[model samples]
Target chain A: MELITWPDERLRRVADVIDVFDKALREQASKLEAVMRAGPAAVGIAAPQVGWLQRLVIVDVTARKGTNNGLLILLNPEIVQWQGSVIGREGCLSVPEYTGNVVRAAELVIEAQDLYGESCRYEASGFEARVIQHELDHLDGLLFTDRIVSRRSDLFLRQGGA
Target chain B: MAEHWFMLTVVGRDRAGIVAQLAQTLFRAGADFGEASMLRLGGNFTIMLMVHFPAGEHSLAESIKAVAEHLQLRVHIDPIDSHLHENEAADVVVSISGADQAGIVAGVTTRLAAVGLDILNLDSTVAGSEASPVYVMRIEGRAREGIEALEPVIAELQREGLDAVLHPVDMLIA
Candidate 1:
C-alpha cells in the first residue's frame, strides 16, 4: 500500500464508512499495521493515509512507557463519550513536515468493530486516547494542522526523525 | 490572474475594531489574506500579515496608510518574496520559564545559537505584578547537529536560574 502525502487530493476526501466485514477488510488492516510499524515511532495509522477511502484505523501504544491497551484495529470507530481536555504536541504521517500543539479530549469511550464484525468498546486515557482522536480525525478529512491552537505559536517542524 | 504580495505590520494602542477596519480596507482593495500573526503586548496591539492583491491595482501600502492614519496606528508595508516556504520539521521544543529578568531572551537564544539550533518560532510573555513578574517562553527549532548536542545547553540554562526542558517532536502517526 502506498502512503499518500500532503497536498494529495485524496488526503482531503472524507473516507467511506465500512459496512462489510470480510477478508478484504482484514487484509487492509494488516497492511496498515505493517506501514505503521515501518515508521520510526508510529503508534497509529488511518486508512485514507494509505490511499484507501475507508473509516478504518490501527492504534497500538504498548511500546511506549505509559498506560495503554496493546493493539486496537478499529473499523468505523466513533467517539461515543469523552470528558476533560488536554493539550499535547502531535505530528502526522500525511503531514510529515510539521508538528503542532492540539487540544484533545483527555478520556474517551470509543466504539468500533473488530475484524470478525464483533462490536468492541474501550475506555482510554493519556497518550493512547490522544492517538485514537488523531486517527479518528482522518475519517472526516480533518488533519492535526487544522486543529492547532495557534498557527503562529503552536506549529513547528519535526526534526531528527520526527 | 496576476497577483502581488506584501508583508504588512501595524502597531498601536489596543482598541476595538482595529482589525475590522483594516480588513475592510483590504476587502475593498480585493486583497487576499495569507498567514498572519496578531497579538496584544502590554497596551499595544500589533499585527503582521501577508496580503496578496491583484497586480495592476493602486498601491496597497498607500491605501492601508490612509486607513492607518484614520485609526491612529503605525503601519509599514514591504514587498516580500512569495516563493519563500516554511522550514523542515524541528527536532525539539524548548520551554523556558522563570522570574522575569533582563537579558533572558538574549541569554537563552544566544546559547541555543551556539549549539547550532535555530529558533524557528518563539512566543514570550511576562505576567504577574510589575514588581515580581514571571517570564515564560516556548521555542521550537531544529537541531543542526543532533539532540545530544542540546543537552549541555539545557543544563547551562537550568544553572542560570531558569527552568528549561527539551522535548523531542515525534511523529505519532504513520
Candidate 2:
C-alpha cells in the first residue's frame, strides 16, 4: 500500500476511539502491520496514518534497539504515568521528507487494550518509549513536526521545486 | 477575487507594537499572511512576510506604503509568482563554531555552494566578549544530489580549524 505522506488532510484528523473490538478490528490491525513492515524502517504505525480514524496503534521496537515488549497492538492506549525526558530525532512515514528533534518521556507506564480486548499495562523506557509517544501523537492529530524541539531548530528554506 | 501574492519586507528600529501595527494594517487591507520570518538584530527589527491579497480591486502598494510611512520603517514589496512555494524541508543541518574571524560566512558558504548545497536558512553571530569572541553559525540547506556529497565538505570545513558537524534529515525514524 502506498503510505499516506505529508500534506494529506487525513493525517491531521483526530482519531475516533475504538469500540466493539471484534474479528474485523483484528484483521485491520493485521493489514496495518503489513503496511508498517512494508515501510522503510518504520517501527510504529497508527490507525489514522492508514486513513482509519480510530485509536489503534502498533509498536514493535523488539531486538532492533532497547528493551521492549516485542509487539504491541494497542487500542485506546493511555499513559498513566511518565518520568524523565530526552530529546531524540524522529521522522514519520506520514511526513516523509523531514526529520526533527522531539523531546519525549524517557520512561512511561501505559494502559492499553490488546487485540483481544483485554486490558494490558506495560512499563517501557528508552527507544521503545519514544516510538510509543510518536505513534500516540497520531491519535490526537499531532505530528513530529508539531512537537519539534525549538523554533530555532524548525527552520525551513524555500526551494525551487518544493 | 483572485489571490495576488507579494513578498513584503520591513526594517526599522525596534519598538513596541510593531507586530500589532503590521497585523492591524494587513487585516484592514484584507491581506492573508503566509510564511514569515521576523527578527531583531542589534537595535533594528526586520520582517519578511508573504502576503496574499485579493486582487479584484484596490491598490496593495498604496495601502502598504501608508502603514510603512507611519511606522517609519523601510519597506520593500515585490510581486511573487502565484505558484511560489513557502518552503522546502532542509536535507541537512550543519553547525560550525570557533574563534571569531573574517570571511567565515563567505568562505564556508562558497564551499557549500561548490559542493552543491542549496542553503535555505542560515544564522551566524558572534558570542563571548569583545576580546575573545566566538563565531557560531547554523545552516539549514538542501543537498540535492545526496547527503553523501557533503562528506568532503564537512571534512574540508573541519580541516580549516572550525568545528563542523552535519546531521542528515533521515537520521532517525519512528
Candidate 3:
C-alpha cells in the first residue's frame, strides 16, 4: 500500500471506525503491517496513511532498542488514561523532509481491539507509548507538526532517516 | 531577467504592523521568499530572509526605501550564490546551564568543534535579576559517530563548570 503524504485531503479527514471485522479489514491490517515491516526505519503506521478510512494501526519497535509489546495490530484504539508529558523529536512518513519536537504523554493506558474484535488494554511507557500516540493522532487528522512545541525552534530539516 | 537569491534583513524597534508592512513592500517589489525567521530580542525586532528577485540595475534598497524610512528600520539585502542549501541533521540534543559567565558560548562551541560535532542550531540567553543570573543554551548538532562518541562531550563540558545533558535523537516513527 502506498503511504499518503502530507497536505493530501484524505490524510486530513478523520478515519471511520471499523464496525465489521471481516476478511477485507483483516487484509488491510496485513497490508499496513507489511508496510511497517518493509521499512527498516518505520516503527508504526496508521490506516489513513495507507489511504484507508477505517480505524486500524500497526506498531512494532522490536527492530530497534526499546521496551515494546512486539507487533500490535490495534483496531479502533482509544486512550483511556494518560500521565506526565515529555517533548521528543518525531518524523513521519507522511510529512517527509522534516522532523519536529512534539510533547506527548510520557505514559498512557490504551484500550483497543485486536483483529479478532477482542478488547485489549495495554499500559505503555517510553518509546512504545510515543509510537502509539503518534499513530493514534493520524486517526484524528492531527500530524506531529500540529503538536510541535514551537514552529521556529522545534521544527528541523531532516538529514537522514532519523 | 536572471533570477538571483539575496539575503534580506530588517531591524527596528518592536512595533505592530512591521511584518505586514515589510511583507507588503516585498510583495509589491516582486521579491519572493520561501524561508525566513523573525524574532524579538532586547525589545528590538529582527527579520532574516532569503529573497528571490530578478537581478537588475535597480537595487532592493531603493524598492523598500519608503517603508524603511517610515518605520525607522534598518534594512540590508545582499546577493547569494544559490538558494538551494543543505541543512544539517542533528544526532543529539545538548543542553547547558550554569551561573552566568563570560565566554560560555565560545568555550562550549570550541569544545564541540574539537569533538568534531557540527552545530546545526543553537539558542542562548541569560535570565534572572541584576544580583544573579543564569546562562542557558540549547544546541542541535551532527555527530560524526553515534552516541558512544557523544557521551564524553558532556563530561568535559561539566568539568568546565557547566551543567550539561545530551540526549540521542528521537526514534523514527511511522
Candidate 4:
C-alpha cells in the first residue's frame, strides 16, 4: 500500500466508516501498520492516508522515549470526551516538508473497536493524546495545516535530514 | 508557465473589515491568496501575504496601491522570483521567557545567526502588567550545525537573565 501524499485528492476525501469487522477490514489494518512502520519516525497512520477510505488508525510511540502507550490500533475511533488544551507542534506523513503549531486536547477519552471487533474505551494524555488527535483528523478529511494556530508564526519547513 | 508571486503587507490601527476589504479588491483584480499571516500586535493589525496573480497582470501593484489608500493602511508590495525553493526542516524549537528588556530579540536572533541556524518562525508577546511586562518568545529554526552546537547560545541567554530551552523537532512521519 502506497502512502498518499499531500494535494492528492484521496487525502482530502472523507473516509468511510468501518462498520463490518470482517476479513477485509482486518487486512486493511495490517496494511496500514506495515506502511506506517516502513516510514522513518512515523508513530501513527490512518487508513485514508493509504487510500483505503476506511476509519482505521494505528499509533505506536514505544520507539519514542519519554512517551507512554506502547501501541494502539483503533478502528472507528471517536473522541468520547476531552478536557483542557495545549499547543504543540505537529507534522504529518501526508503533508511532508512542513510542520505547524496546533492546539489539541491535553487529555482525551476515546472509544474504538479492537482488532477482534470488541468495543473498548481508553484515556490518553500528553503525547499519546496528541497523536490520537492527529490521526483522528485524517478520518475527517482534516490536515494539521488546517488547524494551525497562527500560520505566519506557527508553520515551519523541515530542515534537510530531519 | 511560471506563476507571478508577490509579497503584500498591510499594517494599520486595529479595525474591522480590513481583511474583507483587501480580499475583495484582490479577488476583483484576479489574484489568488497563497500563504498569509495576519495578527494583531499591540494596537495595530498587520497582514503579510503571498499572492499569485495571473501571468499577464502587470498592473497588480497599481490596483493594490488604490486599495491600500482606500483602506487607510500602509501597504508594501514587491515581486518575488518564481522559483521552487524548499527550506530544510528545523531540528530544534526554542522558547525564551523572562522580564521584558531591550535588545532581547536582537540578542537572541544574532546568536542564532552566528550558529548558522535559520529562524523559520518567531512569535513574541509582552504580557503581565504595564509596569512589569514579561516577554516570551517561541522560535522554530533549522540547525545547520548539530543540535549540540546550540548549547552555548542557550547558556548565553540564561546568563543574560532569560530562561531558554531548546527541543528537537521530530519529523518522523515524513
DockQ of every predicted complex: 0.35, 0.31, 0.40, 0.27
Global CA lDDT computed for model 3: 0.80
What does candidate 3's lDDT look like per residue over A1-162, in tens digits? 888888898888899988898888788789888877676489899999878988888888887676778888999999999998776778888887677777889899999999889999998887889999999999989889898875433333222211
TM-score of chain B of each: 0.88, 0.86, 0.89, 0.87
lDDT of 1 at B79: 74
Task: Please tell me the TM-score of chain B in candidate 3 relative to the true structure's chain B.
Answer: 0.89
The TM-score that candidate 4 achieves is 0.76
Report the lDDT tens digits of candidate 1 across residue range B42-109. 88989998888755234787677787988889987777755434645666788888999889999999
Report the lDDT tens digits of candidate 4 across residue range A85-150.
866677788987676678789899999999778998988887788899999999998989998874
Q: Report the C-alpha lDDT of model 2 over A14-122, residue by residue, as the tens digit.
A: 8988778899889889999999998877889998888888999999877474568999998999999999986666778887656667788989999999888899999
Worst 10 residues of 4 chain A by lDDT: A153-162
- Pick the winner on DockQ between candidates 1 and 2: 1
Candidate 1 true-interface contact recovery = 0.45
lDDT of 1 by residue, A1-162 (tens): 978888888888999988899998898789889998887588899999988999999999998887777899999899999998876778888887566678889899999998888899999997899999999998998989899884443343222111
C-alpha DockQ for predicted model 2: 0.31
Candidate 2 residue pairs in backbone clash: none
In candidate 1 chain A, what residue range of length 10 has the lowest lDDT sum? A153-162
Give candidate 3's error at residue A80 in angstroms: 1.5
Q: Which 10 successive residues of model 2 chain B have the least lDDT summed? A: B80-89
Model 2, docking class: acceptable
> Sorted by DockQ, highest first, which candidate order results?
3, 1, 2, 4
